[model samples]
Target: MSAFARSFLKKSLLAASTLLLGMPALAEEAASASLSNPFICRRPSGAAGTITEFPLPTEESSPTSITVGPDLNLWFTQTGTGTIGRMTRDGAVTEFPLPTEYSIPQKITPGFDGNLWFTQLGVNQVGRITPKGVVTEFPLPSAGSSPYGIAAGLDGNLWFTQVTGNRIGRITPAGVVTEFPLPTPEAQPTAIALGAGGKLWFTEVRGNKVGAIATDGTLTEYTVPTANAGPSSITLGWDGAMWFTEQFAGKIGRIGADGTITEYALPDANSGPVDITVGPDGALWFVELRGNRVGRITVSGALTEYDVPTAGSQPAGIVFAPPGFLCVDPHLWFTERGSNQLGRIRAVTVP
Candidate 1:
């Protein structure tokens, strides 16, 4: 862990112990908690009673993203090691070295054609990997592009952010690439997800806006009401609005398809929300990299926070993994950037 994280953990542990000691009768009420340095949590569908933590190869290598691969295994990106890792439902782990040869792989997502697509933030290249672990890479058309986040587009292609290039890129399943520049320079688009409306939605970390692009590479930008909000990750919500995290401003934002934007403040002023996803339970779940918590924002904009066992752990990525009753496994899987551990949170029915 970073020195900052180590110190924060110490303080958090002290606080947790005090919280426990101060209420002797609360022992039975303490939720079951597990993590070497647990970072993020998700509750997979149908598997409501079990939680699983998938450890990384190292204690300091940050795993950045996780998604259910077409092969039915979980695929994640290791930003610290510049590798892609695969962990099967039965707990088998395999890894593939990144092809960029210069930069770390930042984000990863499932492509339309059943391959895993990822971005190389340091080298400006996009990569593809198959269920069998075959990897292919395509160099960005622009120099210093610094591709960050990626997601499958409705057009049977992969769309990604060129954070430094100030553009978004589209790559067909066959690996052909096309680039579209944003109207403003240095937008630093960070994360992207295919919107319900068949368009690609993304966050501009520097530009402080949520933008969209059609399959034809047309660009549209919507400014957030707050300044330096640092909008980071964007995802389609169950409610038909696009939900995003404002990393610096400590709020969640929603954008209508017509280009209107609304912001909701988190309970904490510095949650530093990074990535978000719509859960099966119909809540908007996101990682709080700074506040050290899992944030749940309801469709109606109600905010709830859950503290991870480890503090300052820097949860970065999240995904749902529902195991049936026969397997006895179900929960959400997430990654911790500061602790180099996987986090799992189970859903509890409200009393």
Candidate 2:
């Protein structure tokens, strides 16, 4: 095996062993309270056409995925720190360390039971954190599942994708886990999103297909038009279609409920598009990891790009903070994995 592949395997095995053996508590006190004051950077012009960056207290936090909690706070996973973090709209940041070391938390989502559910890829478990900061964990039945993406399902449960295990899993509010195997072997399912008509849509990064699984466990797969397009993330679009990012092919794709697929190539070649979501302004927004830009794609396939202020930021996740308790208008929240910061793009104009 190549040296790079060997090193990756060694790290994966070490992480799994750490999760299996467990580790001493690192920051038990921080779990129930906020951390130190955050380093907030706000633009002078206020929310209109402004971008803010908030640095996490812990260095190399490596925030991977973010979701708006039910309490209107931003909840995200710190992959490098092995902790779950919460940040208020005003920039108060709190971190809750996971019980298992090297769990490598990935995507986080608000559960229907008034808590946040996240994937622990290294430990092969799913974690739950309450609004008040209490945490609980549930283990998957299969080892080495490597759960990546998670979202609240229409049936009052949480659905997630197992990239290594090549399956879709559902966990109830009570923490019962049931996994469904994918039709194609080794598809490496990555991100998942709840679709219209009470179904869950997901991406098969290795199989180059988009899949739909009913709440009842019925599965259907649709092949992307491009070969090895590397569909990485999937989201529900404003126009009632399922939209996704093609990371390797540098394109955005749309699939109808009836299985018709359409592809739109990005303006920049080799952009490495990753996560995508529907913005509050009725347009689709995404992150370009390689291109160092955030993107907007209209329902009609019109694409526009906005550059991140930090060079080589490697933005990974994007979500919209709707107008509510702390926000006067909707703002886009993203994670700068390369820069170790939380970023916001506010008052964006849709073309």
Candidate 3:
């Protein structure tokens, strides 16, 4: 078997053995990897089996956000097309028309009420779609506010950012939006996620800060140590901290519930880490957008980079698949913006 295939199998077997024995698993989940031990396979053959790319024919199209839909299909936004696209688990692709022109759809997420919610950046709107593809759009009160990132809040509301208006907006499942202005006007909040602590955590891209707003509208902000760090995306870390990516400073940052901030520099300068998510193995997994690679960092802050075989692939928006058999553990899925493809990594081993 090939080096990658063997490594994948080894990892899969290790995972299976641990599970069968009812022992606690400890290895960190990785999105991708290269073999360091020729005899020890690090990723399984079936895990890295095939990669598929889907192209949207719209002008200057790029995917902004992606999420698993209620139907188990992967749904994402096509910014340039003013449309949403869906990819089946078996690789079938379908596109749905948006309700407005120049919608510039940014982020797509599964809402509390089981609808697919997306941000319409250019048109200042939030959209929802049922499992059958019926779309409902809610217009933001502030024109040109540029609603960018979105997530389902703990209170069952859809929360998003106004990249231009410097505000956070909340929408009821019924499409009623109420805008909350951030303290620092024009801070340009980019992405948001719900914390385990029940607060909405987000990144202020232009303001260079990570902030949290309670479900009741109280806001707190934390400044990173590096200037112009450009905090872009935030997710709840398995280590019980909020982890965010510094798009400009090329670092990963951690913020505690009490507002303490720490930063970890990437091995490569200008790596431009963009999005992050909590892995099933309890590590933080992120996308190195400029480096065209997927990376994983343990709770202790150790960084490992995986080189993608395809150059300039631009990995973005990563997530771990729901648990399954040897063919599916630690499975990672991400977007390849430059190539317009969806990529997966399976049976990943840290060592």
User: lDDT of each model, Cα atoms only?
Assistant: 0.76, 0.83, 0.76
Where does candidate 1 stray beyond 4 Å?
A: 1-52, 322-330, 348-351
The C-alpha RMSD in Å for every predicted model, in order, reads 11.5, 13.1, 8.9
User: What is the alpha-carbon lDDT for the whole of candidate 3?
Assistant: 0.76
Q: How many backbone overlaps does candidate 1 show?
A: 3
Q: Pick the candidate with the highest lDDT.
A: 2
- Which residue pairs collide in model 2, if any? none
Question: Relative to the unseen true structure, what is the C-alpha lDDT of residue 343 in candidate 2, on a scale of 0 to 100?
Answer: 88
Write one digit per residue (lDDT tens) for candidate 2, span 301-344: 88878888988888999987623321123468999999999888
Count residue pairs with overlapping backbones in model 2.
0
- Can you tell me which runs of candidate 3 are displaced by over 4 Å? 1-60, 322-329, 347-351
TM-score ranking of the models: 2, 3, 1
Q: Candidate 2 at 156: error in angstroms?
A: 1.0
lDDT of 3 by residue, 71-146 (tens): 5467888776788888765566778988789888888887757678999888878999876789998888878899
- Enumerate clash totals for all models, in the order shown: 3, 0, 7
